[model samples]
Target: MSAAVSTILPIEADQSKPAADPRDLLLHSIYEPDRDIQGLTARELEIIFQAYKKKDLANVPVRKAPSYSEAEQSALELWRQQVNHHMTMRISRYSMGCVSRQHKTSVSPAPRPINRTEHQVFQIPELLDLILSFAGPQVQIRAQQVSTNWRFSAISVISNPKNMETFRSLAPLPPVEYGQLLDDTTRSLPEPDSQQIEQFGLHVDHMVSWWRKLYRRRYVYFPAKLAQRDDLPNGIAQSLNELDVGQRHGDYHGSIHTVSRTTDLYWLDLSQFQINPYFDLLFSEKGRMLHRLGRWEIGLRSNATSETLVLDDSSSEKLLVQAVGSMHITNPPCRSLGIYCYDNCVFPMHGTHILLRRIRNSNGIRVAELLDALQSCAPQLLTKWVKCAEHLRRNVTETGHWVDSVWLIPGTPRFRIHLDNCDMSDEVSYATAVWTPEMARDAETLIGASLGYQAHITRTAYMSAEPPRATKEGEWLPEELFEPMKTECGRSNINWDA
Candidate 1:
């Protein structure tokens, strides 16, 4: 307190009075009257304040805060708008439902009316980058609800292909709450007119019927043991004439039936496909869109890199829809499957999921006789792999044969895909492998047993659902698999010198 306040003598100074407890003092101070009380002048209070706190308060210097960038200011303003909108709705609701409208108060001057901007803020893509960077799923939904303009801008920015070549679209934000929340339209805008809806290329009148793939190719290697597992594809390698199935390369080495399909990509063709195929989408997330490669069609490197925006949810407000399709391929002989072999090749006998040949290395064995030995000895373990021309669909024959082989079967599962296999050689499934230790051990043993120097085992896995991927690989290692009992034995061990 002030010096004057401190100097005030207590009433208890009189010997005639009994000492009072703090509680009694407080009660008396609140309820009793005191006529002799004195007040300090403002000047006296200042003097006391200066004497006690001059150095701490008066001597402290003030510094200007750093200014926000245009983007930052825009982000702040967007959030401010959200708060204002939410509060306005809540107050309006309260006024209608709870407050007594009949009550009147003294006349007061009316507040000034707000003058909103003539142009919509959401029409600007540059502004969207800044706003989206600061938004979460909830905030995004709010933006979508603000007006048609905002909804279009947000979707356009996210669907734009240019973002990725620097990466936009939720890079800084948390994942969108897809499937959990529906897009809500507030501000009660009248049903959007044709011009507004056309701006976004969304169809509210007629829903699209079919989506087709731009192209398709499939590869199935021999040793398609349907009897091996009940989970295998039914129509694979069944000698169908219209289906384009059967072996060309497998005649000498091991049977490899290559199936190619060029058809309208109905959504159903995807899940029922019997072979391993490279699948991709060509949808334009911002406008007219949605396409997928036929299922069971082997993926080519050309198909790997796509420019289309991927879907996260199916929201009419956000214009999103989910697409998924995959078949069980027991032993997929296609590119990017099991051991990741190329197209048009049969697995040579022995057991080789893949053959890593450097630019200088020649084909070790005649491609014709390779699959023959293994298929004859262990037809049950026939692996489906790819054959490559020095270069196959591309002009890189020089480096075409050079591949990074990561997985094997008949041994413990390895890597992210488990490098594990189903029972059938050409089995294609729509389910993703959970990849347990048991799964890993089973594959390792089978692979460890099947391959000789000539031995090769590449287990292929196919799933139509999205493969889990992270932008930055965090702390993780492949699950540890038990070592096969005979780790160091293969047909290559049989020295021809014998």
Candidate 2:
């Protein structure tokens, strides 16, 4: 009656279903040997308990010398052997991961768009003018360099998004080109890239020059005939008006939005959004356009110079309540707001460079401890995806047809102030520390709450949880189990017997 044995709940058997093949279950799972039918052997269960919990099987005695049976002794030996083997495997995996990351490219400044877009579609003066107006990566730095028509296009798109189909238009994205990025070694990884980096008296002139350039029209390329969109942030509107009225004094006031991750990483970290693959309206012209934008490749580049980054004003942004209009960004007043490393096992970020931008309380000892706590959580990238599945299903269900667009939630929540504060963190700390079943469950929680991500669990854990469940036709819950669910606090006139 020790805690280990007491904590392990027994699963009810499916009396109507055929027994599953142990080999098949083993083939599909790395850790699990389906405890229902193709169940764990005595040694197999012990191996898991020892490997993860550092405990023997729930049924096994806490102390095992005199009371041990021959089978239990064998199981103990097998557990010890398996533990050694897995430890070696873990070391090997970590070594290989180090080598692999060396070859992987970190964020780099992107290739500047050509002086003029020569694609056949943009050759026409009218079409080129309109396409250039819509923002995001496609419009690029060429926006300011172009002719009057180019100026007109941006104004057109903002006034009415009906012209934004080209921006939302989807096609097979080409492989990313990494050849021509400007590598500023001084301002690179150690420097923290942009705005949130500079602190104290050492960089006053730098800030002055930077602000001077921004006020001098070198920063924003706001259009002349601008008709404000309905959803423009109030601060941005004030900034725009200041830019207009303050034009003569060379004064500029504006709200600045900062983002940390590169664009390619944006769509990949989609747990922050609710995407419905099953929406019927997605097939329609408008819905198709909106959905296509969700799939659009925004490219691989650092957000360093992307001061122009704006949320697409899609339905997804509405769900996120986007405190600030950017991805993978924690807003002010949140600890680790500008900090972007989640230490995801699957898609870990290279964040030593982000320390360059750590502003405010980041220098304090308490901040370092928080940083360590964040690292210890070591969230998997797709945990949010699995967690977001319920949200997506609920959103779609509540919306009930007539859906027009997908949604992105920018919920870059703070990590728990204390490790014990997160209920799932206890199991997740172990799971994500290496790998385990709870890693999958905690992944979703981490994504939405810690990282601005959402989506599904890994195939292994998902399959283990959902293992090709089969049931006889018309099979229902057992009568014994069903009877307990009949208890109700809410008033109901319906008969329970029926």
Candidate 3:
């Protein structure tokens, strides 16, 4: 007989004695707990257990009764389920083994190799680099893990500086709310206060809030005027026009403009200009228009460097987003600033947008406050803003959704995107003009619009030619937009104007 048949074949019971009680049989097996009964092996004990399972001890009534509690019954049922699961697995494995053995014996001796050439084509340096450059950072890192060749190929391709440009070129164009003005055929614009730029520019806090807002957005003259100042010396005012400042090429006329917060940008001026400097529109190949607001600045560089500092425009924005995002998720103290700084890949320049030192010292600030301020002043940037927030929250904090304080400077420019904590006594006082010549020029235009939007609502109301006038005093203002915002600001003892 086979070993399996010999082990499982039943022994005929003698017809003289009564059948053994199932309870006594179970008691005999478990009474000692540790000492093996009759020196039975694991397989022998399993056979006896299987016999009890087949008889269904759960339903069988014992003459010598010991009833089980509900808890005990539930536990017993769960244990039975587990045993059943194991049995099913064992049967499946045995069946699979038999089928595999049979298959091996009957199959052909020679098997055709899979066509790896199709998969191998992706490893081609040029094609792989191009494809990988289009993927987000997360996907690129994962692709590197597939094989040694892939890691080498991905590392080399992603490391190239040229891929940055390719990434930008290939990315979907940003949504432009105000840039549409640049395209419309109407010579006369919808009323200044009625415009999207004016509505988004209503915040009273930062100089960026009111400073860049246009007095007039007659698209015809604005672009031309901005272009003229490209040669102007120290003409930061040209930024007001949202003109492309960096290097330009035939294939690409200029960089894209965006209002979203998550983008990789060269410059960002917070003042009233609707197409805020970095957020300005770009007229690219064949009049292609797109926003630059929410894109991340993926300026790739090799990791094998020491004492490295890179002059990147968006690094400050990236790190600030990271820092604020980190604080939101981790709820850590100021020391956590070091971790954020270290993760930035490069040391950001001071006064570029936000300084690491200033953030480290800012115990009074909260990431929510930063986000709230952005939403109030520039709601369009919120999605990318939150993306940056979540990225830092998950990666640095190693958690999701937390809150904490951070350092911030008090008051300057319209937008509070950056804060300065210069020591008042130690810092040298200079007789610097409050507004630069360009700023002063932009201010005149902004003041005119502000007065019209605020105090002159009555005057413009009766005119049928214009859209509906701003209904109340400071009616178009951000403070008036939502009641909760005003209440929160009030609780914080912060003056929106101040």
Candidate 4:
């Protein structure tokens, strides 16, 4: 063991021998030029190759070289530069993409503002006028609430004088310019043409407010104000084609005389006003000024059972006759006349027919007096006329048993007879007069024929009766007088005087 120890210690290998260059080893590990390295880098490939080669090479460690071969060093330098360049490019591209996305997200189009000028170009007044023309009454009022512009437009359109005229022209006659007048009063401003405000329609509250204002100004009559305010838009006098003065009760009366005098009204519906004493004022000397009148409707408060006598001495009929007759004599010749005896349920036989005949024959004087005198001259004619009378009476009945009958007779002088209370009783009998006593004899013959028709009707009624009559047909007095008159009995060619 001593001899071995002395000699074997000298067998130490050369530890100072030069080590293989690490760069050369690294190059050798990745030296395969034909090898395909896709996602893996050169360093990763080298690591993998060295890991596998390590088993075959034993535990020998590679040496660190001071420098590398030209080809190996170049390849290494190129690889490092390529990696750095790719990273830099990728960072630049990512930053550019992020900026582009942010720019797209942040950008937005500007919102447009409402153009007042464009709106004004359509002309607010014209727009409002169009709206009123196309829209109904409710829409006109509702348009005011749409916006401040709409409100202003509506007011301006209604208040403007020219626009008001257009509105009036568009209205059906008797033209109503109520909306224009209302706009003027609501703003507390004098209307542009007050004379044009002939007919007005106001809400209940608004009418009260207007009355109060007018009363404060000591306006005794609406007509005078109408004439004075000619410059006012839609004045009462100028626009006065038809006047409707509404009142809640029959006791109400208006100073319509002055208004009628100043206005050219064709129809006057004073249905809200009372008849009795107020009617006296209406048909007074001053009130008779309504010469243009074509139709008149006035309300009465009298009961059905009440006897409303319109005697020739002093009655609305006489006043109306005088008023209408005077107008007829003046030669303009009024064609149509309508009298609505509202609430006056009792129908006066003599007065109503006389009035109707007078109004009908006013233009032709030849028929006027003849018609008037016929009232007393023919008692049989009166009985025959009872049908018309009964018809007129039934019209205003509360029970609605009889309805008004209107007939339009077509001829050169066309006439319309409106029976307020029409009766359809088959039991009513009538008599008619003929030219001479001989013609009267012929009428009796016609009556005899008419009686024959009645016989059949009576026989039918007797058969249907619950308890049959004991009397035989021959035993009975024929019941001819009780039968309805022929239809011809209702027709007459005789012209009656007014």
Report the number of the highest-TM-score candidate. Answer: 3
lDDT value, candidate 1, whole model: 0.25
Worst 10 residues of 4 by lDDT: 402-411
* Model 3 lDDT per residue over 1-498, tens place: 122322322334333333434443543333222333333544565665554333322222122223346654454445434433433332232233444566567754694553444366686877876777777444455555455565555555544545433122222222111112222221211233334333333321233333234221111112221221222223233333332211111122324332211221221111112221111111111122222221111111111111111111233333323322322211111111110011121111111122112222333233434333333333222222223333332331221100111101111111212111222111111123575767654543342232121211111111101111222112112332212221110011212221
Model 4's TM-score against the true structure: 0.17
For TM-score, candidate 1 versus 3, the one ahead is: 3
lDDT, candidate 1, at 480: 18
lDDT, each prediction: 0.25, 0.26, 0.28, 0.27
lDDT of 4 by residue, 391-427 (tens): 3223212111000111111001111112111111112
lDDT of 2 by residue, 242-287 (tens): 4333322111112213321122121121111222121111122122
Candidate 2 segments exceeding 4 Å error: 1-66, 95-328, 331-498
TM-score of each: 0.17, 0.18, 0.19, 0.17
Better of 1 and 3 by lDDT: 3
Q: What does candidate 1 score on TM?
A: 0.17
Sorted on TM-score, highest at the top, how do the candidates line up? 3, 2, 1, 4
Candidate 3: Cα lDDT at 120? 65
